[model samples]
Target: MTEHKPGGDLTLGGQRVHERLTREEPDLVARVLARIQAEVADYRRLPVEELAGDIARITQQTVRAFARCLREDRDLNAAELRQIGASAVRRAEEGFPLEAVLAAYHVGTREIFAVGSADAGSADVADLLEVADRTLAFVGTVTGAVTRGYLEELRTKIGQEHTARRTLLSVLADGGPVDAVARSAGIALPARYLVLSVELGPHADEATPGIDADIAIRRKLRRFLAAFEHSCGDGVLASLDGPGGLVLLPLAGRLSAVPEWGSLLGTAGRAAGVDVLAAADTAAPSEVREVAGRTGEVLDVLRWFGRPPGLYRLDDVLVEYQLTRPGEARDRLAAVLAPLDAHPELVETLSTYLELDTNRRRTAARLHVHPNTVDYRLRRVRDLTDIDPLHPAGLPRIIAALAARRASLPR
Candidate 1:
């Protein structure tokens, strides 16, 4: 042990502390390992024999590093810090939380302090203070390095998992071979799958300005879908693409599960403070691209029609969707409704009357008007559009025009 001279510098004090720690290192390491294993639940859960070996090795290495810092009168260099950080990554990979790793460090620090202070018999007060300062500084550096390493490892792991999932989902969405992709993903292909196109309803971002609403909505949807996936024990794969998110949910046995899953997703979206518009179609893995394309069309039609936020299926908007496919057809249909632009109310009456099986009394009741008024609006609609609603041939064209108009309305 180095002799402590009166009025010596901090370096001398550090040397004294280092010598004391060196003599008591074995006992001090044992005490800290015991304290940590007893206090931390994670440590207690680890295999006893293997944990004992790991603790002994780690404690010895850490104590030796601390002793070198004290003797050399310097902080740990980058290499030393990196070593500690590497240990942190390993601990994190072993499923130990940052708190648990930090708690172990704290326990080690306490043990070092207890042993050093006891061995400080009749030492100068200034030397004791210097010892305390150096000890705290050393511990702080180690803790910060370990924290960085732990977080970095976590980020890396998450990024890898995200990339893998995205790749698999992309392949599935592109109609690639299911067996190859599923094997690569290490997940079994479900019997039936539903491809859903999800997006935030119009005006969903009204309250939250200056932020990327689309990204925000996509993130929330991902989280909600993840929870839903866990609840069902089925693999729910999702990816954020061009305008919205695509989710592929696997069903156990029946197409009947679509409504139930859609309902649950609706509830989840509402809870997240966004009105989600989801369009779904069921298909086998090989037909994922087909179903996804159909669902995408459903979403587009819903947007064009300014449909309310909710889950929609192909059957719900088939007519409007089919009619809007051909550009020329849509233009002609728009021309059909052109004459009725001056009589918007007549168009509304015609739509309502057609929806009510052309029943005059029902249409009047729905519009909160008299039956005579309904008759008058129907007459106006026919005169303006040159298509009588009472005529069978004219009624179909009138209905198609109405559908096109609804699909063309701005969202």
Candidate 2:
């Protein structure tokens, strides 16, 4: 391609006109165009030293592009306009304002034309200036609107990506994040404890009523966690899985960060009318099965012991609960377990059966009853409640009931 010839710097018009265009037009395109050719930087001359340096830089880029188009007679066709429009659309899609970018162009055009017209170039210079003005105005409008449309699509994609990321974190916290793609967000999660909080509040029931997990509640939880992060100090944060999703908080040490977390949780949970349980990692990680198992056991104590539900600190009370039938009543315990004695065998049988691996033969052997006797007792057991003792999950409930029974059992 032939190199374009360079042009003269814009001359301030005699006295009156000189000052008008000089202060207004920063990029003197007319002066650059006068020589019939302009180098890239020739369009960058500015008057006011104001706006720091940004105005000069933006104007420089635009002037260069406009000048290049002028010299090459580059057609601002469907493709170019669409691309520009797409750019504008993308911004709109991103939930950003379009008017700002377009307004800058408006200011830039007035500046360029006023300066350019003051200087002489060709017989058609006036016409060229007018056409340039109209084209840019049209381009600004088209590009801005088009970009917003694209931005709408762009934000939607971003929102989806955010949701997917949240889901992945849920997996990672539960055990591991899975996808065909790579996840390398700059967060470190080494939680010994995992708590899942569902966003709930005056609005929760009203929002996402059918979805089970409310979007607004999730947003609140996210905001709460973000606030909690600084207090977490060495903690890692991931997006909440959803209203029902869990958050994995890897403690730095034995409940090191948990003690400090109450106030923050209190403020956050108050809005929801209930504290979020931040469920235990309802499953185990293949990698840290043992530690996870211990953690799971600790969570069981918290859930069954009837401690108020919002947030519980296991590391501190863990040893106490781990020492016995989760710290229950005996003779003084009968005064303690008098409440549980009302359903004495219900609790006793469950506790004993679980201790014996839910095997009828072993439970019978442990309870010192005939195997048939154990079967009969279990049948009476099933008849009283919806809980199915034969099932493994019944362990948590069975254990708690027994503890409550142990609390109420007679001397």
Candidate 3:
């Protein structure tokens, strides 16, 4: 067993080329920067004096590293690869286009080839070809490292921003130092926010046997985020956990265009292929803590009554909201429907009747029953509860009782 020295096999011309490249590395690096500034608009827009110095330093380092690799006929060592990666990350942080970065490397390589092979005799053809092959390999390796480093930095940056936004939302909703958190998160606190508690219903694919439920849920979540981002831009903040979570949308004073939330929710639901239900209310920054809880309760009441997919504000569900609160009255009201527990059909008919504005025919149509059957069920409900659902006094009481029962029951 012996040491493998691939570079020992380099032809005379190849060795000369490697030395020239190493000695002229500074000039080669400058040429690379000049080419990039000429060809790439993004690079040209950077502050010329300061950025050019920085680019020249890194480009010289890169050129020397490749020269060493060429001389040894070996690949970049771990430390060299790390240096390349660090430089790439810096460029990404400075908002440099990856295409321009790669173009700079190509320019450097082309310059090296032009000088290295300029006076190559016919006998040096093999070495020149070998160098060309190695240069191509070098490009592949360096570009791969550059891309990986650039994307990783970008992803970390995005994740940090997301975490900061989430933290800001928490402070706003849970009573904390709002100004400090907003400053740290780089968010401007608005005078008011339309706080929302959202509940996303399962998509049809979630229940299908062969489809992956998690994938369906993620797809819906992405659509929801994209829709909200498109409509509200960066002003809308949210924390989504599984089926639902809190959202805060910044208000832009009287002159700001407030989105028609109903239409937006509809578009979100359609895009996500899921049912969207949200409870919303507006509040000043200082009042967000209170409105946040109120919005959550509003959503709870809406869900307890099995409301259809849509947006609901406190005003829309005031009666149900009041009746669902805990008390002896609520318990007694809930008990009014207890007798009909064994007679589910009667309870269903009465609930539907009340829901449809006491319209008998609409209840019959909704329940898929004849009008005669609807009448019979109403009579049975009256006998069982000792309350006629049609009477003005009885209507409100029964509606409250049903709401209380639904609230107390498991969802």
Model number with the top TM-score: 3
RMSD in order of candidates: 5.9, 14.6, 3.9
Candidate 1, 1-411: lDDT as tens digits:
757533223433345667777888988888888888878777887787756787677777788788888777778898888888988999878777899899888778877877776745455566777677777998899899999999999999878767777777788888677788678767788877867888854335534779786676566655566655665554777875434578887766433566686677666565555578888888888888888888987888877565677889989987768887758888788688788887778878887788778899999999999999999988888878788897787877887777677666765
Write the residue-wise lDDT of candidate 2 on 1-411 in tens digits. 645322222122322232343444443643423321122232234234422343444345455445444444454455555555554554454454445545545555555555545554565454444445544664565455455566667777667756665654555445554332223533343424444333333344435547544565565655556655554553443544343333445554433544444555565566444455432332223333344444444544554454444555455445435433434432232243333346766556666676666788888778787888777666666666545677777655555454444334333
Worst ten in a row by lDDT for model 3: 250-259
How displaced is residue 407 in candidate 2, in Å?
16
- How far out, in Å, is residue 320 in model 1? 4.7
Consecutive 10-residue window with the lowest summed lDDT within model 1: 5-14
Best by lDDT: 3
Q: By TM-score, how accurate is candidate 3?
A: 0.83
Give the alpha carbon lDDT tens digit for every residue of 1-411 in model 3. Answer: 645435435454545666887777767777777777787677778787755677777778778887788677789888888888888899889878888887877776677677666677789766767777877888888888888888889899889988898888888889889889988788888888878899988888889999998988888888887887777778788888659788787765431443477777788778888888999888988789999999998998987676888988899998889889988888888998899999989888987898788999999999998999999988888889988887787887777788889877876
Worst 10 residues of 2 by lDDT: 6-15
Residue 8 error for model 1, in Å?
A: 11
* Candidates sorted by TM-score, best first: 3, 1, 2
Model 3 / residue 160 / CA error / Å: 3.1
User: Candidate 2, overall lDDT?
Assistant: 0.48
